[model samples]
Target: MHSRLVAVAATAAIALMAPTGALAQDATPMASPVGESLFAELGLPELTITVTDEGIEIDRSDIEAGRYLVTLNNESAEPEVFAGFVQIPEDRTLEDLSYADEVAAGTPIPEEGPAEEDFLWLYETYIAGGPSTVTEAARQVVVNLPAGSYGVWDEDPTSPRLAAALTVTGDPGVRVEGPEPEAAVTIIEEGEGGVGFSFRLDGEFVAGPQVVKVLNASDQPHFVEVSQYPEEITVEQVMATFMFDPSSGATPSPDMLDYERAIFAGWAGTQSPGATQWVIVDVAPGQVLVDCFIPDPLAEFTPHAFEGMLQLFEVAES
Candidate 1:
């Protein structure tokens, strides 16, 4: 949908999720760096991870229920990238992960979805963030959790980091539900609207932690940002910030994260044609504006929003 622009915490984890297609199937073992102070800059509880030619390992296995920044430290000979996902019910193991089988068996995610709404929940159907590479600095996801068992499903099953387990003790603390693609907002690029973006929301205003599915209905890859503009702000004023020319095909550089200008809601990372991924964003009660900042790389990197990929919607009380 209009990717998210506000509330980047839980959404960042969902937004940074890498697609399985990019993961290289390898037999090499992997392990996450255990306890380390790398997250001092972030000032959040750090869970450093290392994935290499070894089995999965963590700094400390027991973590109380709360929010944390899950960072990956790659020490493999070759470039290594990874993604993390957590599920409730201590009994659900990697081998037992049969959501598809359930689908084939007539049980679906909607019915079998984690029934506990009070605890942290996460489910990713479509891949997000393209694919995360561990070589470039540290890859991270900020997540909240509760007291229970968590299955860290490394996006790729082949990696040594696959099926890592993490235990959470104490109370359900802060509830952080994962991203679910139950709702969708198909982003059409250039069909009836000429050259910009349009939206197809799932319903009126069904609330909860939502996994907004964004699709690139256009020929070119695109991204969307959900932001809140001040009442005085106009589309023309915002458009001026981007210097893009369709004919020139020049890549216009604009500040993607302008937290000072407007309220950053959440994001829909760049998506390829026919590619759809779920992005997490907590929709609050107010006016939410959606815009695409990605330039049409095929069209000389012209900003899609200038071509008409912008709109506004309201989030009423559910």
Candidate 2:
């Protein structure tokens, strides 16, 4: 199933990138324009929602008005599922917001979780698959205000990470870019025995210059660091350097490794499902290790390498 999804996604991406003559005619219309003065017209401040591997983030401090439009952009290669509502401190809650269009008829009100009353159902769609230029408008429902800090997050118990924020009287023009890249590495799980990880040279074993893109597909935020060790370093020596730790209360000692002078590091402070980072480095015929570190406090105070989040590669003579 996972492989099928990947294949479909790749195909969709290819179709989207195809030239006008080679593209299909059944392509759906992209998202509509968000409107020139969305903030001024709606009496709401401009808002931006950034989806990352760590979670969702809202630029403004609060939501003060009854009506507003929120724009969400997916910067990752996977689809993002948004389901929940904006929370306010008052005794009332807003539950009439819509995505692309109003909520489906008879959609039940969410009765559980942080933003229960403000339940909204938005289907999962690939951000990369949408038209290069797409603008989506979401109807902002009115919620009685009590003047307090409120936040938005995935309502699904399975996904409890916060995605954005709303401040009653905070600045409205704030804009947040996606997370930064800290490191580049691959993760290899070895079942129950243990795991192994390493870096890549040109995405394969052959020597040459390569560009590596690191994606945080996990629920929490993560960081990446690339370091080069001596050329004589062995694979075992390289695995000892990468580390990982989770915020969910899990800690495990990472097996370190050695590398050369060239290193690329990608870090995600709070990587939500759709967060990603990338790095480019050149490698000659030698060995390298790519490491992913996640410090989770709940499960164990350990890095991803301890949990087997590492990928190793060897560059052969060209």
Candidate 3:
């Protein structure tokens, strides 16, 4: 069974966003460069899943069951979340369940426990969140679906729009190449910088229009934002945008977004503790800044990146 969390389709476009469940920290926006670890060669079946707090969008609702490269892209604002998985007992069809109303109202789906069904578990992944856009980019995950009905739900299981039914038909699958992964980068969320949460990368950033994956080694749920610092902005000035500094209450400069110094690379969504997912993205080289924008609920929703969970990498042109 395979399931993907967050991935940006390989491109120079800004991709993926991370939205935490219910909390503001879950919606930290990020941008990052893609490293060519692998994925230059695997050709597997892939599907595009676009989601928001309101509803879910599966490019192809009716598909043959098998192993697939699924891209989970959050194309809305904060608090919106989405995920995919197959369940044995499909209580109802996608039409039987209601979704249009909730999406129209832009209401967030409430979290729900697994439904009362004595069904065997199939391939799945914990829901990942990020509020960027497909126009910007997206991430990837590999999931195996045996011919069966599946549920693609979010944090809110109680939500009418929460669990939608997907019909997977055909024989079982065996392919795992497209989403396995080639290049990898480890993000350590230790408070190394002493300001907030410090980030340490164990690999180098590479450029590509390839499939990708990310592994989170930190306790806090996290995502990757790749961009470049502004010529005039100071790292301290940028960090000030995140937390309540003891020295002074330094907030992020409004000009930061208005001026736009961080050249956008792309973003991936938040991964649950120790879950790895794949994403396809195109990356450009430069002085890249990797950080997590998930807010700390304990600290007035301060972004982890501001607190100190940030690292700088030089993406060499390929």
Number of the predicted model whose TM-score against the real structure is largest: 3
C-alpha lDDT (0 to 100) for residue 33 of candidate 1 = 39
TM-score for each candidate, following the candidate numbering: 0.39, 0.31, 0.52
lDDT of 3 at 89: 50
Per residue, candidate 2 scores C-alpha lDDT tens digits across 10-68 of: 11121111111112122122223334422333343334555454565556654553223
Which 10 residues in a row give candidate 1 its minimum summed lDDT? 1-10
Specify the poorest-scoring 10-residue window by lDDT in model 2. Answer: 126-135
For residues 29-89, could you state the per-residue lDDT of candidate 1 as single tens digits? 3344322322334455656666454433456578876556565655556454444434445
Q: How accurate locally, in lDDT, is each candidate?
A: 0.43, 0.32, 0.45
Per-candidate total of colliding backbone pairs = 27, 85, 54
Best by lDDT: 3
lDDT of 3 by residue, 206-306 (tens): 66544445665555555656555434344554443433233554564564422233445545555444445555444566555666754443444445655
lDDT of model 2 at position 138: 22
lDDT of predicted model 2: 0.32
Global CA lDDT computed for model 1 = 0.43
